[model samples]
Target: MDELSWFRVLNPNSKNPDGHARSYEIVNQNYANKTIAEFTPHISFTNYRACQEYATANLNAGCPGKSVLDYVEEDTLELTDPVAWVNVGFHHTDKDEDQSPMPIHWQKFQIVPRDFFAQKPTITEARSCVNGPTGGAVNSTTRPCIATNTELPTVSTDTEDPTTGTTLTATPGAWNEARTTWNYQYLWFRDGEPITSLDEEGNEVGATGETYVLTAADLGSDITVKVTASRTGYPSGTAESEAVAVSGGAEPEPEPEPEPEPGAVTSKVKASATKVKAGKKPTVTVTVNATGVTPTGKVTVTHKGKLVGSGKLKNGTVKFKLKAFSKKGKYQVAVSYGGSGKVLGSSKTITVKVKKK
Candidate 1:
């Protein structure tokens, strides 16, 4: 189509240069064959009269001068397998500009983006790197996003010494750092039906909270405390205590074992950039810490809920170089420290946005 005039679609309010779809075309002096006659006269696109005529026309009939739209006599435009018609012209006849050794003349145009991106793709903000004793230089090229997780957090129920006249205590599971909000609910079930009681406020309630005291009605019956936990981004979860039964008669019971003190290790994750290009790796640093002690552990990394990488900690820090994603979008990374004998396991998560290279 280098011998005819051509044009492009434009959005007047677009922020892109020339307000077009990132392309430029100039009017010329030649015409291109983009009609049904030029369409190879093969398969019919629809049952319309124009489509049937174009598909069955003989080659000798030659291409028509009128545009494709002229063939449609109907008021409302409707067609299958639509095709665009564009013509470009560039006449190369004898002229002052066509001298034997005339310098090459060039015309350039481009379609710039407008709203394709919510904001500028390269407008990423800098972030702090995870700094631990064993830490290396922080990555300075990645773009960061708010990370989120969908996996349900671990949930468990605890009971006070079962021998202490059937007193039960419930301890909620730890919440993930990515979670923004959550709550807990306690319930007791017998023979698959819920058992409830009136709270001190005289409101009817189920066996609730972190503690439960056995009653006379519980004798010779199985008791269970179920704790339901929820967080902002992850799915809600319920954990039930192992079924315990009230004995037939009062008898001497073994002393309950003391609970082990929980470790105090915590961890944080830092990413080189919140935004990165597809096929470009992003460096992630995880720092493990304990309030009053040095931390040691094997760190595991997960994207979403799937494990992606793992490594051993050195000087309370672990680093991971994520594999380049083949496509562009937001991805979440979770780093967890599987604590040593003196530390507790902890995790941190962050979000990364991938862009075109």
Candidate 2:
């Protein structure tokens, strides 16, 4: 059986001199140790030399006065190969709950990530999507900056026996959320197209947890399903199951990969005002035009190499409302198109003048 475990992250820029940024600890306990040893043997070591001597020491007499933690606190000696030890022991008090057939117990350790990232790793930029410089330009509604959950959920499919199976069923694992509850939506697919379930009245409905009965038309296809989980305020997440082939059906044909498009898409950025007073918000729009294809990707704006804003492209452009500048100066604003699979990337730089507040 697999054990359940989690880890923690630490800030790398922490001022602690020990540089104890990250550490992973694993502790395993054996109940037999309590009975066989004098001091209830605990794994402890100072350095490579002490570890060598301790391993050779007789089990009859465990380290009498030197625990690994003790050595760490007391000894200032530097070591070439240092080792830290941790102990996991089940605690018991003289209470009624300490019966013979004990309830499930756990012995665990922690893995810490110290000073891992300079900032919150998942932060996203604030920006808005608009059609153009028309009525929707300044009035565009900004999409809330929500991070997509990339952790795939677990799904299993059951089809009874291989010979006579005509129906397949799928089950989804619980979506675990820390601060809120998760609601789930499921979708079923044959090959790559969607499949829907029908209610008793024959009205189409969601295919969540529904059985998929095989038909003559679906004889050569494989079946798969996907589940999306979302909370009221949090971003939504999606996960898909591995495709399950029909019992005695022809193998599904694989879809061909699209070839990479030839020419690169170009980007041009224009600000609403060439000059604006400090603390005044200005809108910047990036137009990504291709000769023969529509560009689909994100546009990122940087001011003197610092990321200012970013947004996704709709139609052929992405718009960003620049935050107010606190200081007045001439700034170089650069916009880059992070091109999609069918489009190559391009960038453009422009200058914006900011006056005194």
Candidate 3:
């Protein structure tokens, strides 16, 4: 029998000084190809007592050379049955250390057994029938043959302003997945699109898993969020999760407040005297036509670029008196609706001809 066919034995009793029993085999001397007994001795209360009785009885009954029994003399012996079977043909070794050992090696089978019932199939072989020859055959079966349990991991999105280092919390929606455990091939997305870096060019920066971390740049204005999940095992190509939009982050500043509409006022300034005599006062009137603005402040009159007179407008009109006009051939007169800083309406400039008087 092969090494796999030999059953490993264990000792269970604490009182037993002997440790666990090793693998052992039983073969027929007349028909070396045939196996008589293939089992490991059990060390439990029941099995240990049974093995002890059997070993003692067999050793006393059969001839010492033909019947060989090996056991641990510990308080108790524990053992397990051989889980698998293998073929070890031909040579034999000495049962005790005193005996000269035979050179035991693997020998070819004299004749290959055809569908032998004695040899049992391996665990892997039993499972193979359940899982057909083709890949993913289990999923295609109409009846449920396989059951799976899944545990989804939590995911979060975080963003920080590069300049200010201000942190912003991004709301990470639910990660989508057809099944909890992926088929172990292809990229998986928590939302919709494949998880990628926040760079301008969407690159495959993250690992090929369901969870994804989005940086500040990735959460920019143009970026939209969606979850996608996929794997190779399923025949549906790639399975996708639901799409979820990410929220949070500083919004752009609002447009500047509109400036107040300009005051509706039109003013005209003119000189009454065409020719002005030296040391003579020149009379001037500043008229304004404004629908909204109330003419309340004093009007400033200027002649030849000099402040000659000042007066207040009673009802959108102002008349001013000029004193001691300087000697000149001609001069320009400008009237301001309000005096200096108090200007509210409008201002107009007119030509004034000055003559020697």
Candidate 4:
């Protein structure tokens, strides 16, 4: 048999037993008799039942004299049971007389390798420590120090400028000083180990600025910053700045814009009224006078606080008719232009009084 060839066994009663009808192939095959190398079989009830029934019925029908019987006995028959008479009623008593034979046969070998075991590495175990902060006098040999759980030591040095009235203070977080060169402004760490990368606080070993403009997204509680400073012609120094608490610094967001007021002026809308019968409709010619602020949107006309009609502003004014306002007392005419999120001009309220016909 190959490494993992599939095979099926005929054992109807064997389904109740473990590995009775399963197919398996040789995995090791290193034994002298190749017994230990043979892989275990996987037994399924359906296959076992069908195969055992077929083999039993064939044996019972006196069909052993045929070539099929010889092949089954030679290839599938167990040494303990020469006749290989499997009790069909072992698991299921209601055996079908018309049960068909399973064409699939159990093979001794397979082509694929067996999958059993594999491991992965964690982040801390995989990272390596690089060169980091060292402590010593200027021009003296400095020993490499691994960043541990302790807070980074502070390095400080100061110089008084005779020309300037200010005394220059240089901490580990300070940048401009008497030093020649610096790796970065701040120190980073992973699992208490000093990292040669920049820290989240922007303080490495030589960082300095009056005000750090950190992004709003980076503002959070427990955020810390370490300062490193160095100056030309002076010994370099490092210092841990006081941690800035973001909890108290957050501010409220601004309010949204309000809706535009009604009766706002857009382009000019000419107004004209004609007298008519009591029941008749009165034509109100609203000639958009001058294109005031040329409205870029739809114009709405209101009469006596009710929206009488609305139309797109074409050539500045739109002509509309009002039936209810034809015969009325006093009518308030208002023209509003502008949609949401936009501001348009507003006209003074126009009053029109209608007399009875």
Q: Using Cα atoms with residue i matched to residue i, what is each candidate's TM-score against the true structure? A: 0.26, 0.26, 0.23, 0.22
Give, for candidate 4, the lowest lDDT window spanning 10 residues. Answer: 114-123
Model 2 per-residue lDDT tens digits across residues 1-357: 224433333334453333456443344443313543433444444565333233223232334444444455555775546554444554455557667666676766655544444334554332221212323222112233232343443434453432333666655554543334566676876554576668999998755664555666555444666777665434565666655554455433423323455654443433332467553555677778776778777777777655656778899877766644534688788877767667767787777777763
For each candidate, the alpha-carbon lDDT, in order, equals 0.49, 0.54, 0.38, 0.36
**Per-residue lDDT value at 143 in model 2:** 31
| lDDT, residue 307, model 3 | 60
TM-score of 1: 0.26
Task: Write down the worst ten-residue block by lDDT for model 3.
Answer: 143-152
Q: Tell me, what's the RMSD of every candidate?
A: 21.1, 28.9, 31.8, 26.2
Tens digits of per-residue lDDT for model 3 on 255-332?
A: 332233454344344324344544345667666554445445556666555465677667656665564433445666
- Give lDDT tens digits, candidate 4, residues 90-204: 1123346535753343323233322211111231311211112323323222221212112333322232211112222323433332213444355422111232326788755
TM-score of 2: 0.26
Q: Which stretches of candidate 4 lie over 4 Å from their true place?
A: 1-269, 289-294, 326-328, 339-343
Worst 10 residues of 1 by lDDT: 140-149
Q: Candidate 1 lDDT, tens digit per residue, 84-158?
A: 332222234568866678667543333333354433556432222121231343232221121212332221325
